[model samples]
Target: MDQERIASAITRVRETLAEHAAEMRYRDSEAIATIEAGLRVKVNGPHGASIVTDMPNGVGGEGSAPSPGWILRSAVASCVATLIAMRAAEEGVDLPGLEVMVDSESDDRGLLGIGAVPAGPLSMRVIVRAQGTSDDARAREIIAWGKAHCPVCDAVERAVPVQLTIELPGS
Candidate 1:
């Protein structure tokens, strides 16, 4: 990790925020996905990274890659881990090892239109394991701060309005 570069970037971000007040620049991210094979999708991001998503064989898919729910969990876990590490670094905490685990349970009956259950996960859990921290109080503080500061964690905890539009050919 390039500490100097990270410090410089953080400084630049602070300066930008200070200059812009509440009118900060917006960062936009987009992903494109194309249907691969049965219940599989190939998603391509702007960073030249691609991932294959598929459903389990029970759900009429070959179970090639991870499901969308798993991907969401992975995103939450990875974002929390990164935010914790970055915050620890900023606070001069020497963390040798950090692990984050995220889990959620969903009722698929709603998706399958079999029952009146919710289509999303019922609940989510996030667990963090950190090494090289002696003070349990400080470690708890850091973990709490990380949870509050992580954007993904915030999004997951709150309900954000989403507008969906569908376009079909010849329609």
Candidate 2:
């Protein structure tokens, strides 16, 4: 119930992270994931391309695209949705429709023309929608809680340290 105590706790945790940052590594792993019986993914890509299984309805994608990054982004949105839903439920709020729209900007200056953004997704925008029962204050509170709980949102907002290791096939 004390804001000062909560703030102190958070500060202590962050201090711990800073103390152990040098020992931290961005550990990576992969697993074979199947979407439906038809779509599968060869998660560990020793080769340049990952094999895709049967194509979806009409996209001809074999229901597979680049993994890891997309999966992380989807997880971000899912985290937001889940946290918001949980908060709303706890507060006895009813929402008819809820959605999160996320997009990223990439730079293609050299590859494209002038004023092109960048070569990677520069930013993401999430628009949350909710039709609730006359509880706008609770809705806003839920949204705030969602933002506060999302790991991806916290990482981006706080600029977490990242260590990069690129392993070429022969390297």
Candidate 3:
């Protein structure tokens, strides 16, 4: 979207969050993904939205969809792009050709249970390109601020706690 439209959307989002501060801040949400027998995973969200993920055929998967890691990369890239657009809009900078690329670096042996490597990506690189604007400095400022403010990026960078539970069929 153009600067004006983006600004309007950002304002709406901010207002909504502020107006529903309590509910928005502490909403109970969970991602549900189910796999029947193989590596294919189906994730369902509200409003009937869904996503399917799979590993490659070589790894005993259907290979019909993107892998889970691909989804993670997409989430990070898209979130950064959205925040950048919002910041640019706030500053009235037009970015008609904004683009973002996310590169996830992982060790194959990690997931394969080799050595002591981690199962997640060791590092990630984000490339942001802005076009249709000659304000290079302002564009850089927006990109920097937006990238810094991305929640997904922060989550990936920082350590977060996770709990595991095993459910049996009957008892």
The candidate that achieves the highest TM-score relative to the unseen native structure = 1
Off by over 4 Å in 1: 1-5, 22-27
lDDT of 1 by residue, 39-102 (tens): 9999998879898999999989999899988998998999988877766666666556788999
lDDT of 3 by residue, 1-171 (tens): 467887888899889999988777564456799995599898988878898999988879988899999999999999999989889888887777889999988987899999999999999999998767787888888999999999899989889687798889995
Clashes of each: 0, 6, 0
TM-scores, all models, native as reference: 0.90, 0.52, 0.87
> Highest lDDT among the candidates is held by which one?
3
**What is the TM-score of candidate 2?**
0.52
Per-prediction RMSD in angstroms? 1.8, 8.8, 2.2
> Which stretch of 10 consecutive residues in model 3 shows the poorest summed lDDT?
22-31
Q: C-alpha displacement of 8 in model 1, angstroms?
A: 4.1
Per-residue error (Å), model 1, residue 34: 1.4
| Candidate 3 overall lDDT versus native | 0.88
lDDT values of the candidates?
0.83, 0.63, 0.88
- Per-residue accuracy of model 2 over 1-171 as CA lDDT, tens digit each: 333454466667668889999876775544344465444455435445344444344533454554444555666788888767666655556666888655555454622455755434577777788875587777888788986888776765576676777869999
